[model samples]
Target chain A: MDETILKTEEQDFIEEDICVAENLVYHKPKTLTDTDLHYCPGCGHGVVHRLLMEVVEEMNIQDKVIGVAPVGCAVFAYNYMDIDMQEAAHGRATAVATGIIRVLPDKLVFTYQGDGDLAAIGTAETIHTCNRGENILIVFINNAVYGMTSGQMAPTTLPGMVTTTSPFGRDVKTMGYPLKITDLVAQLPGTYYVTRQAVNNAGNVRKAKKAIQKAFQFLQQRKGTCFIEIVSNCPSNWKMTPVESNKFVEEVMIPNYPLGDLKVPKEEQK
Target chain B: MGELRLMKGNEALAEAAIRSGCDAYFGYPITPQSEVLEYLSREAFNRTGMIVLQAESEVASINMIYGAAGAGKRAMTSSSSPGISLMQEGISYIAAAELPCLIVNVSRGGPGLGTIQPSQGDYFQATKGGGHGDYKLIVLAPSSVQEMADFVRLGFDLADKYRNPVMILADGAIGQMMEKVELFEQLPRGGTYSKPWATTGKTKDRERNIITSLHIDPRQMEKINLRLQKKYKEIQEKEVRYETFKIEDADYILTAFGLGARICKKVVEIGREKGYKLGLIRPITLFPFPFKVYSEIAEKVKGILDVEMNAGQMVEDVKLSVNGKTRVEFYGRMGGIIPTPEEILEYFENKFLKGE
Candidate 1:
């Protein structure tokens, strides 16, 4: 017991010896709380959460922003995000965000939603809110499967992809083709900026961060609905290791749902 | 009289909402209640800068109310029977989150779009837990255009006082019928109460506040349920309200609510002219129901007649109030049919004083 105590003390001392500054190029933003995330290993939700808060922190608008969390895997996003956050009912985050932004027009607002919450049940709300030109940022995380409920086929699930619901792979002839909701919404005049991004690699992560920053800037300008669809991966649901799942996202997901800006403001046209 | 004017019940309620300093009104177009949305749209926005939005559906409207109320704004929505049915899900969430808001239901007959005519059919859905969990709404049954106007302020106050949703349950007839109403003086927005628990973007001086009803832990969920039950119990003890007509030394009592009670008022006079000692009991607050009055009246009255537009929904509550000490009978007109005062009196005499 004495030796164990000595070893623990020595380990503590060694840990203290290794300072945080040496090669410490990155750290969590203060806009994120101290609560440990309940996300599974290698899930894109953690990175997205970090990057979103980092942008909020960088902009120095943490106190002036409110976020609505959807009723999917990110339902407890309010637990981690250190802002005035509201947890919305299933498929109602966009509508909930609409309410907030309408009441507190000057306060920056955003909603983080998963595909099932946005594209399936909340499609009408999402469409109407965007159509009404509600000035808010909508960060949609489309992983192509319902991660929280265990790999159910989502509205964005790729054709021929096997999910728990689609036991024999998705047949578009019967299950209907995957919806390109962002593509659909980009055509609306209310959408100021609409982009499909990915967080599969270091480079793509940077791009996603930039997109979020631009969206927040647009929100500050009151430039109507800004949507960012992050084509993320759900490793646990996809039945692959984190690396394999990301490789699948890069090779499979991107080819079908192409990344990059689908729409931009009129002044920034071309 | 502060701004006395003759107005329809729907118009009076809308005018009252503006005067009560409501922060936002979100609703959809449904028959018998569309006037609420139209009235607010025509008169509210340009004057008060209040957010008035016509949502896509009752589902959208209620969720919008959830968001606005969660942010500590005085929010509300209005709809008829089918529309209120669609709002039940969001209403449950609002109640669980303990956000103060008002919901007005100018109810129509429904068992799936039964009719666009008047109804008190939603008594059970309004008083009982309408959604998945154990929760309650402070239900106000407005019988007159004046009550329709007056209850808007009272509903908001009760909602703010308890941090729970308050519902104004009216029927199609009351919503359409015009009567004299005195609107309250305008109150400034956000001046009535301080919202310490609102998710209004936490500032430097305060800790962040989260508005959510998702409690993952069973233990924590039970604790929340207990807290809600305690609040409901307190409301029941304090908020019981009833309007009586000639109850002193009466042998028979007539109990009804909303327009049904208005009809019963005349029934009381009709019965008295015929030498029957009759009185009327009108429940003002439906959820914190005037159960005590019925219990006390049961000690002396021979019987009680529960008149309603629905097929005897409130009769169940009337029975519970009397607790079988005295006979509680029901007389109902179904499918949007409004029984006349003479018809109700005849039914009462046939049911109670027959062959006298």
Candidate 2:
């Protein structure tokens, strides 16, 4: 040894060893394409997409599952998810999913929609598709704002939350209260399973993934409309960093949208 | 073997849809066309495993059609005038997305729910691209119960061929009237055409396809519009269908479609009996509007009578086709009232032949 400080290849050796060990702990879901996500860094959409792909890959139903993409932030979901996808008109994901399910009843059909796409313009479609008991999975992302259209007030936006359209904070007296669409949909007899969840932390992320998995499982049983409402975060629209947005979801958003199972089959009820 | 049975135009069209191997029918009940949904709901599922849904409203029905059509299934919806108006927005989206589907407008009178009786007021809405944007539907104006049944299969074929929505523009009279219809044999499922672009599901062999009308880039959107325009041009050149009666050595011509053509045909016979030298041109496809035939007739005939059930809606197209080369006159009945052949002949004799 020359006694001069020499950088060793030990760092590379250690990294390789750790990666081999980590292989048992974590791996990218194969259903997710290699393309990098286009979602904002702090956005919850990426996490939701990953959870969905993970479920898809783990279930080994990639070829049989068809997804309907809504016309919001998740519009480009087809680019990242390796499954077949149909892009629906604004608020028409449930309708589109109903179509796919009807024509290919053997296939697993799911719709990924935003709050605006579900509770606003597509309200009739959402309500009727559920009422009709279409055996499909609906993953509704309630971010309290229209993330794709740049912070416009959504039907799920908090009563007092400030948005671009409600710059002075939402006035419930004039603008009407935020819609409890999950609760409303749960009342429909056609809906067999309904849940409201959040993905703010690792533990919550695991729970949200479970809920989505349950929804798909119910659809497989042809139990009827399986709806999973995920109250997520839009960090950029909320004017916060990813860390702060996660914190906000815990403190402020959770109070407005509590996470739990809203409805289930009588036998599975808890 | 195919069977011939007496059927209401609406029911015949519904039967024809099932025989055409239509995958789905999503609709709401509306007068003059409720038989379509009622018949399909009662029979389509048991007969062919077709999906028939009674949607919440016309808006929901049309959106459901958009969804099914996007999945590369043959879907259809039917409504009267008011319901059809509610469907225009969804129809426009379907058109923009380039999804193939069938829409039957068993038209009643309208400006706003005017009447539940027969009227051809939706002629402008149909041939002019009812919803919005620079778009067109392959509008087939069915004048008889036979045509109503025949056009269902024809509409689906044309829609599949062009990847565009097709409209069977029937009126209340034709939709409600019962006549003998020769039903076609059921075509094999998946028929003669294949949808390579449909969003059925993704297989490993091909990249995932997205059915969308959204192209943020203006240039890209313009290219889509241009593509649709070129397709429409091809349709115009190849699918311009019309029937000419007694055009041999005629001095006056009558142009009409749907119920209007039925009345005009009678008027043509009446005029010819009176030795006024009259003929009729019934444009079967309202969109590809027989303009070439009209242009040719404009030079040979001295005048043309445009008859319609509304306040002279199709007359504008008639004028455009004639281009002031020969005199074109209009005679119309309004608000759910059907024009009589005698009145139409009187209007024609007084307006165009006599130059009154």
Candidate 3:
């Protein structure tokens, strides 16, 4: 019994040494509230939210930034992020953000929307706000299916991907092609920077954080719409474990989305 | 008078909005009210540095107003009936969020794009919660060009006071017709009003402010509805405004609003000349309805004639106000038709005075 106790004490000492402050590599972003996240376990939304809050904290614009939340899974974003937020009607975030930035021209504004909200109901607002060159940032999360409404077909859903609405697996002939909305938005003259990213792993999460930071900086520069499309995963609705969902995103989603900067300002053209 | 000018009611309202220190104007072109957008587009930017945007559509314009107003900026949008119909959803959200904003509807005839001419067909839609839910817009009916200019400030003030959307309900005739107007002095852009509810930003001094209408919990949403109801009741008690035109010792009353009231004023004078004892009650604020004034006049008058440019929408409110104490009759000219003063007088002679 004493030998067992000594062995346990030695193991605890090793863990304590490894977990010391000097060895700590990461912590929660300052902008994220202390409240536990309401997102599903292993869902990409929490990671995206954390990365966004981290970027906002790193940029030190917490006091000057206003965010518009969409009517989907991220609807409770205001409760999680310690920033002023306007909850927009389905697909009206960009329009609402346009209104805010127009009047309070000194403030930084961004809209966080999902594929269903941005690509379907909010098509007009999304297209026109960008066309008007409103200096705002838009962070789009495309998870192929509607996560909030329990896995319905989305505008960005793969042509043959099955959803509740498409019970028999989406037939391309009937379901039509998945919209490449980011590409379409890049064609508009009002957009200054447009990129597609993901957050499936540590490296991708870092890239997405950098993209969000740049989009916000572009808004400060009075550049037109700065758009970042994040192709994420919906493990719970995808009916797969988080690991399998991550694998699906890597193998299937990336081929369809193809991450990279689709457009950049002339000065940053490369 | 600050400065008397012969201005169309639409242009006068636009000028008044500028002087009221509107921070932004997002509008789309619609007939009979197009002059408002044009005038603001030409004048507001240079005069007050107001943000004037000709939105792609009225849907976009109202949403823009929603955004700007959410940021605590004084914002407005002007549209005719068809455009206003498109704006109903955004207006409902604005009302639900309790954001202060102004909407001026220079109404045209419409069940659907009926005409670009003068009509008060939208009385029901205006006063009785045109948008969904238990929401009420402070509906102000302006009778003349002077009132059009005057109500612009009043609408903004009442909207700010209630933290609700306010509407200036004018018909196409009142919007297009030119008359003398005395413009009010400009209020400062950041006036005395403080908007702590606005989603401006999260300053260090206060917690973050959220502008939202969504309450997933039914009990919580009911509380919001009740709060809105309490505000509407308070407005009804405090902001009931109507002009009594020679109602003392009158045998009958002519109830009308906006351009209909303008015509009814002439009818009252001519009916008096004909020895019919007709008086007019002009509703300045249509939603508050001035129901108490009706009760006060109910004993003096034998009957009431509700005149409108619709097929008798406000007459229902008139009947409810009179409560069958006095006989209530309605005469209307729909599909962009405006009843002449002579026609109204003849109707008063035949319908109420002579009891034919």
DockQ of each: 0.83, 0.64, 0.83
Q: How accurately is candidate 1 docked according to DockQ?
A: 0.83
Model 2, B55: alpha-carbon shift in Å?
0.9
Q: Could you tell me how far off, in angstroms, the CA of residue B189 lies in candidate 3 after the best superposition?
A: 1.1
The DockQ-based order of candidates, best leading, equals 1, 3, 2
Which segments of model 2 are wrong by more than 4 Å? A1-8, A21-24, A267-270
- Candidate 2 residue-wise lDDT, A1-270, digit = tens: 543323356666767777685468878998889998889997889999999999988887787788988989999898889887877878878877877787788888999999999999999889988898899998999999999989999998898899999999999999889999999999999999999989899999999999988877887788899999988999899999999999999999888888898887888854
Off by over 4 Å in 1: A1-23
Model 3 ranges with Cα > 4 A deviation: A1-16, B353-356
Expressed as tens digits, the lDDT of each residue in A1-270 for candidate 3 is 689999999999999889889998899987899988888877899998888889889889998899999999999899899999998888888988988998999899999999999999899889998888899999999999999999999988897788999988877788888999999999999989999999999899999998988888888888889999999999988998999999999999999999999997888774
Can you give the lDDT of residue B112 in candidate 1? 95
Backbone clash total, candidate 1? 0
Query: What is the per-residue lDDT of model 1 for residues B1-356, given as tens digits with 9 covering 90 to 100?
Result: 69889999999999999989999999999989888899999988887888899998889999999999988999999999999999999999999999999999999887898999998899999999778789999999999999999999999999999999999999999999999887889898754789998888879899899999999999999999999999999999999999999999789899999999999999999889999899999999998998999999999988888899988888998898899898888888888899999998888777556732
Give residue B162's lDDT in candidate 3 (0 to 100). Answer: 89
* lDDT of each residue in B1-356, candidate 2, tens digit only: 57989999999999999999999999999898999999999999998899998888888778778878887899999999999998898888888988999999999988896889999999999988778799999999999999999999999999999999999999999999999888999876444778888777677788776777777789999999999999999999999999999988889888899988888888878888998898899999998888889988899988888888999888998899989999998888889999899988877766566783
DockQ of 2: 0.64
Task: Give the alpha-carbon lDDT of every model.
Answer: 0.93, 0.88, 0.90
